[model samples]
Target: MKKHCMGRVVAASAVLVSSGAIAFVPASAASATEADCDGIGVIGVFKAVESGASFNYNGRRVELQNESALDRYSRAEIKSGRKAGDRLWVDRSFHAFPDFKGIVSDQSAKSDGWKMCGPYTGSRTQSVFNANYAARACAEIDGTTLCGKWYVD
Candidate 1:
């Protein structure tokens, strides 16, 4: 009886394949951040205000840049947290795309810190940047965890 069941299953699969109803096609390979790019290059800019470092998602590391900007942002973020309508900007020109920006909204506190959700607008790419209390910008694209910056802000 087990052999008969296996034979029937094989016959059914053969029939489906022959009729083109079960054509097997290889799934196209995707990179970790492919969804983040969405066919357009995406560059994430985050500032570690407390540390005076700039974090880029593309590099996945921190670099020293404008200390004044980092300090100011750090103070503001640590003081009152991100306010509604606070803007986060990304220069699409830098990434070979167009300009895209998002605003802070829907703020909530988590165990680690505060989380803010906002969407990027005025671009072909549909993406959102979530800011955390640790001063990191996080976005998950294509099953990949992308983050930028880490500080008070």
Candidate 2:
């Protein structure tokens, strides 16, 4: 459910930003959206951002400035091999997302989707799932970058 909320927020933000009606946003915000991100290495798994929007990557909690920022940080975290739940600071001031590369743990990768070792309680502790399922399923049951699923055993 959290992921869905964040996703909606990001989607809505994109609309607002494109419409040129979102106030208090930096002028460079337009550029950030057009960040030629293709071919750019993944920054890291997005944790929580200063504004409270967040997501799960490799079963870790990540926050971001918004959904777009979360997506950027999520990729970076995976590529950098940072541990689950690590934080990546998005520096919109510099148009960069920075990570602390040394904190990674070399753990074995797990299957895609939610891996619940126990019963589900519909809470943050139940199991990791695809961000899209939004808590409907005990686990999303697969992992993929496109859908923003990142669960490691």
Candidate 3:
């Protein structure tokens, strides 16, 4: 009977967290200050590939550079893959990331012409300097748009 009671106590101790994670909170835990984190973070390295053109099949990355009050640049790097050669391309932006759902970065911010992804290179960059903006990376190929998550850079 004691063992069963202990098991029940232990089972009641844990809590579930968002992002499909499990956490254990002590029954004695006090209500502390509200958490400041919004739970958004780096989208990390990702891949964008299709039949006609495969760019960054191995890995692609979104980078935050020159962080400042007025000169930040969001870069997309096609780490490796078959050359995009104009058929495949990478795009990135600052301000809003893909996870925001209906919220998308300003269209004008995608200033780079489609030619941004050149046959000889695997990188392109765009700039939008803002204090509260985040980073988003995407690729266009074979009539499909693949986007990774976004994060506050």
Indicate which candidate wins on lDDT.
3
Give the alpha-carbon lDDT of every model.
0.24, 0.22, 0.30
How many pairs collide in each candidate, listed in order? 1, 18, 0
Candidate 2 whole-model C-alpha lDDT, 0 to 1? 0.22
| Error at 97, model 2, angstroms | 19
- In the range 1-81, model 1's lDDT, one tens digit per residue, is 111111111111111123221212122111222233222332343233322223332223322211242222221111122
Comparing candidate 2 with candidate 3, which one achieves the higher TM-score? 3
Deviation (Å) of 31 in candidate 3 = 50
Ordered by TM-score, highest first, the candidates read 3, 1, 2
Q: Which whole-number lDDT from 0 to 100 does residue 122 have in model 2?
A: 23
The weakest ten consecutive residues by lDDT in model 1 span 1-10
Q: Give the 10-residue window scoring lowest on summed lDDT in candidate 2.
A: 102-111
Residue-level lDDT of model 3, residues 31-108, one tens digit each, is 111121111222333332222122232344322232333333333444444345412222223233324322223232
Candidate 2 vs candidate 3: the lDDT winner is 3
